[model samples]
Target chain A: MHVLIIGAAGMVGRKLLDRIAHEDGVLGGEVTRLTLVDVVEPTAPGPLDAITRSLALDLSDAGAAAQLIAERPDIIFHLAAIVSGEAEADFEKGYRVNLDGTRALFDAIRAEGLKEPYRPRVIFASSVAVFGAPFPEKIGDEFFTTPLTSYGTQKAIAELLLADYSRRGIFDGIGIRLPTICVRPGKPNKAASGFFSNILREPLAGQEAVLPVEEDVLHWFASPRSAAGFFVHAATLDLEKVGLRRNLTMPGLSATVRDEIAALERVAGAKAVRLIRREPDETIRRIVAGWPRDFDARRAAELGFKAETRFDDIIRAHIEDELGGKI
Target chain B: MHVLIIGAAGMVGRKLLDRIAHEDGVLGGEVTRLTLVDVVEPTAPGPLDAITRSLALDLSDAGAAAQLIAERPDIIFHLAAIVSGEAEADFEKGYRVNLDGTRALFDAIRAEGLKEPYRPRVIFASSVAVFGAPFPEKIGDEFFTTPLTSYGTQKAIAELLLADYSRRGIFDGIGIRLPTICVRPGKPNKAASGFFSNILREPLAGQEAVLPVEEDVLHWFASPRSAAGFFVHAATLDLEKVGLRRNLTMPGLSATVRDEIAALERVAGAKAVRLIRREPDETIRRIVAGWPRDFDARRAAELGFKAETRFDDIIRAHIEDELGGKI
Candidate 1:
C-alpha cells in the first residue's frame, strides 16, 4: 500500500510522517512507498530503502494538482492551508491557496474516474474556525457555519464541496475540523490563540513568554500527536459508515488560561508558571472572545475518534513527542 | 423615497409592483420614483403618472450592476433567479446567473463606497431549498446546509457572501429563505414540488392534477402573499437589530398531503378533494423526499414576520387573494 501526504512540511504533517515511518505497516497492510508534497521540498527525515519520494510543487497551479494525483496513490492526506493571520491580511492569496488549491485537488480526482474506476481515500484537515460567534455552551453536530473570517469561510465552503463530490462518487472523503494544537512546539508566535500554548511551552523550557489575554479566557485544544492520529484514522476508516455526511468535528479539550497554568504547575512545578508575563493585548482579547470554547463530539466519538481526556495529558504528549520523552 | 426592483417582469415582482402602487407610500415614506429592471422589457404594470421608469438590461453583464447602484435608490429589491429545475438541469447557466450575478451586484455596491459614502437596503429572495437531505425534526437558526442540488448550493453561497459583505459595512442586507409557495396560480408545471400545490389548486379550478407522493410525506409552505410580505418586511427592517447575520428562514405552515387534501375538502367540499388524481410518480417522489419538512422560525417571528397559521388558512388565503373568494 502507498500513501500521499500534502503540506508535508507543516508541524502536524511532520509528526504524521514520523508516526507512519515507525508503524511501517498501516491497517494490516505493508506500506511500500510514501509520497511527500509541499510548496517547499519535504526532507525525507530518515533512511529510506528506495520507496520514499519528495516533491515541491504549487498545488493551486492549473495542472499541478492533476500531475500529483495521476500517480494514483491509494490514500491521500490533504493538510495544506494558508494560516489565519496571513489569510485575514491577504484576501486574494488566501482564496487562491486555500480555496482554489483544495478545489483543484478534488476536481483532479474526479476527472481521473473517466479513464478507469478510481476511488482513493482522502482525509482533509479542517479547523474549528469554521464555527464563528454566538455559539452555544457545547456546539452540537448540527451547528450551522457562520464564519466571521475569510479563512473560516474558505474551509466551510471546502467542506460543502467535499461532501457533494463524495456523494457524487468522485472519491471517499472525510473532513475533520481540528481543535487548536496545544503546547505547539517552537518559539512564541503571533497567532491570537498562540498564548494558549506559549504560556506553557516557553516557560517549561525555561524561557520567558508573553501572556496576551486574561487568564480566564477559555479555548479548545488537541495535541499535535492527536491531530496526526486523527488523519490516519480517517484515512483508513470505513467511509461507508460515515454516510453521506463526511465532515466531523474532532474531539478536543476545552480549557481556560488559568487551567493551563494550573496544569503546568502540576507537571513542572510552580517555578515554570512564574516565567509568564501579565500584559493583556486588547486585539487578541477581542478575537479570542469570539472563538468557540467547547463542542459536542457525539458523532465523532461514535465513529472511534479519540483525544486527550485532560489538559495535563495534552502538554505531556507534546513534550514527549517533540522533546523525546524528557522535558 | 425611491426604490429599484430587479427582475421586475417575474410573477412576484409584478405582484409587488401592484401592491406598492396600491399602497401609495412604502416604508412609511412618500415614494418619488421606482426603477423597474429586467432582461425582457417589463410592460408598465399600471398607470404610473410619471413616478415609474423601466429599463431592460441583463443584470449579470459587465458594468450593469455598478451602473444600477450608481442611481442610488433608497432600497433595492433583488428578485432574480433561474428556477430550481433549470438550475439543476443546466449546471453552467445555474452558476453564471445565480452565483456570478449575485456577486457582481454586491461588488458593485462595495465599489460605490470607495468613491463616496453610499449604502442601500438590499432585500434578496433566497429559498428553503438551501436546506437539503437528512433533515432533523425542526431545522432551527443553527442547522447545517447540506443542499442536495445545485440551486441550493448557489443560494447558500449567496447567503454567506451577503452576511460577509454586510459585516464589512458594504450594504445593509437581508436574505429571506422562502418556503415552497403553495396553491400556485398557473398551469401544472415541471417543478418536482409543483405537485404539492397543483394537487389542490388545479382541483379547485376544476382541472385534473396528479398526486406524486404518499399522502403522509410532509413539507413546509407559505402563500404568495406571505412571501411578498416577507420581502417588504425585510426591506424596512432596522438591520442593526439583525447586525451581521443577514440570512433568515421565513415563517411557514408545515403539513402533509393528507392535511392539504383535508383542508381542500373543508374549503371547497368533497368535490375539490376528489379532483386530485392519485397517481404516484417516482421522479417527483424522489425529489420531494429530499426536502426539509419543518423549520423553527423563532428569529423571523421575533422580528414580526408572519405566515398563514394553518393549511385551511393557506387555502383560504389563495382563494381570497387570487380568486376573489370564489374558490
Candidate 2:
C-alpha cells in the first residue's frame, strides 16, 4: 500500500513516520510507496529512505491539492495546519491556509474520483481547541464546538467538510481530536500552554523551568507516542463502524499541575521537582483558565484507541521516547 | 435603518416584509430605505414602494455579494438558500450557493469594512437541519451538530463562520436555526417533509391532502409568522448578551401528526379534517425518521424569541396570515 503524509515535517508527522518505519512500513498493509509533503521538503528515516519521496508544497496554492491527489495514494494523512497562535494573529492567512487549504484538498479528492474509482482512507489531525471556554467539567463526545479562536473555528469547519465529503463517498475519513502533547520535546516557546510542557521537559533535561499557573490548575494531555498512535489507528480502523459521524475525541490523561509535579518527583527524584520555579503570569493563567480541563472521550476509547491513564505513565513515555529511557 | 432582504421573494421573506409594512417600516428603528434582492425581481409592498429598491441577483455569481455589501445596509437579512431537497440532489450546487455564496457575502462585508468602517447587523436564516438523527428526547443548545445531509452540513458550516466573524467584530451576525415551517403558505409540493404542511394546509383550503408517515410521527415546527418574527427579533437583539455563541436554535412546537389533526379539527370543523387522505409512504417515513423530533430551545426562548406552544395556535396563525381572518 502507498501512504501519503501531509505536513510530514511536523512533530506528530515525524513520529508517525518513525512508527511506520520501525514496524516495517506496515499500517494495516506494507506501505511500499511513501510520499511526505510539507511546506519544506521532509527527510525520511534510514530504513524507509529508498521507497520515500518528499515534496515542498503549500496546499493553499491553486492546483497544489490536485497535484498531490493526482498520485492517488491509498492512505492520506492530512496533518497540515497553521498553528493556533499564528492563525489567531493573522486572520486572512489563517483562513487561507487552514480552512481553504483543507477544503481544496477534499475537493481535489472528489475531482480525482470523478475521473475514476478512487476512495482513499483519509486521517485528519484535529485539535481539542475545537471546544472553547465555559465547557462542562468533563466535555462529552456529543458536546457542541463553539471555538473561541480563529484557528479553532477553522479546524471545526474542516472537520465538518471531512464528514460531509466522507458521507458523499469521496473518501473514507476519520478526524482524531488530539489532546495537548505533554513534555513536548523542544526548546521552550512563548505559547500560553507552553509551560505545561516546559516545566516537565526542561526539568528532565537538568534545566530550570518556570511554572506559570497555580499547582491545582488542570488540563488534558497525551504523550507524543500516543498522538502518533491515534493517526495510525484511525488509518486502519473499519470506518463503517464509525457511521456518519467521522470525528472522534481521543482519550487522554486529565491531570492537574500538582499531579504532574508529583509524577516528576516520583520519576526523576526531588531535584527535578525543585527545578520548577514559581512565577505565575496572569495573562497565561487567564488564557489557561478558559481551556478544557477534562473530557469524556468515551467514543474513541470504545473504538480501541488507547492513552496513558496515569500521569506517571505519561512522564515515563516521554523519557523512553525522547530522553532515550535514561531520565 | 437601511434594511436589505436577500431572498425577498420567499414565503418568510414576504411575511417579514408584510410585517414591516404593517408597522410602517420600523425594525428597531425607522427604516428609511429598503433593498430587496432575489434570483428574480421582488415586488415591494404598496406601503413601502416609494422607499424600496428591488433587484434581481444570484449571490453565488462573482461580484454579486460585493455589490450588495457596497450598499452597506444597516440591517441585512440573508434568507437566500437552495432548499434542502434540491441541495441534497445536487452536491456542487449546494456548496456553491449555500456555502460559497454565504462566505462571499461575509468576506465582502469584511472587505468593505477594511476600506471604510461598515459593520452591518447580519441576521442569517439557518435551519434545524443542522442536527441529524438519534437525538436526545430534546436536543439542547449545547448539542453538537452532526448533520446527515449536504444541506445541513452547509448550514452548520455557515453558522460556524457567522460566529467567528461576529467574534472578530467584522459584523454583528446572528444565525437563527429555524424549525420546519408548518402550514407553509403555498401550493402543495413533492418535498419529503412537505406533508407536514400539506396535510394541514390543503385540508384547510377545502382540498384533499395525503398523509404520508404514521399519525404518531412527531416533528418540530413553527408558523411562517413566527419564522419571520424570529429574523426580525434577531435583527434588533443586543448581541452583547449573546456573547460569542452567535447561532441559536429557535423555539418551536414539537407535535405529532395526531396533534396536528386534532388542532385542525379544533380550528376548522371536522369536515375540514375529513379532507385528509391516509396513504403511507415508506420512503418518506425512512427519510423523516432521521430528522430531529424535539428540541430544548430554552436559550432561544430566554432570549425573547417566541413560538406558539399549542398546535391550534399554529393553525390559527396560518388562517390569520394566509387566509382571511374568517376561516
lDDT of 2 by residue, B214-282 (tens): 999999999998998998888879998898999999999999999999999999989989999999889
TM-score of each predicted structure versus truth = 0.92, 0.99
Best by DockQ: 2
Candidate 1: residue A254 lDDT (0-100)? 87
Where does candidate 2 clash, by residue pair?
none
Per-residue lDDT of candidate 1, residues A1-327 (tens digit): 778889999988897887777776544367678889898988766744367899998789889899888998888889999998898887667878887899889878977876888888888888998888999999888889888887887788788777866876788899999999987888878888888888989988888889988888888889998888888788778887998878899998888899899999899888899999999899999999999999998898899999988989988997787678777
Poorest 10 consecutive residues of model 1 chain B by lDDT?
B41-50
Clashing pairs in 1: none
lDDT (tens digit, per residue) of candidate 1 on B237-321: 7888886678899999999999999999999999888888889888888878889999998899888899988999888888987
Q: Judge the docking of candidate 1 as incorrect, acceptable, medium or high.
A: medium
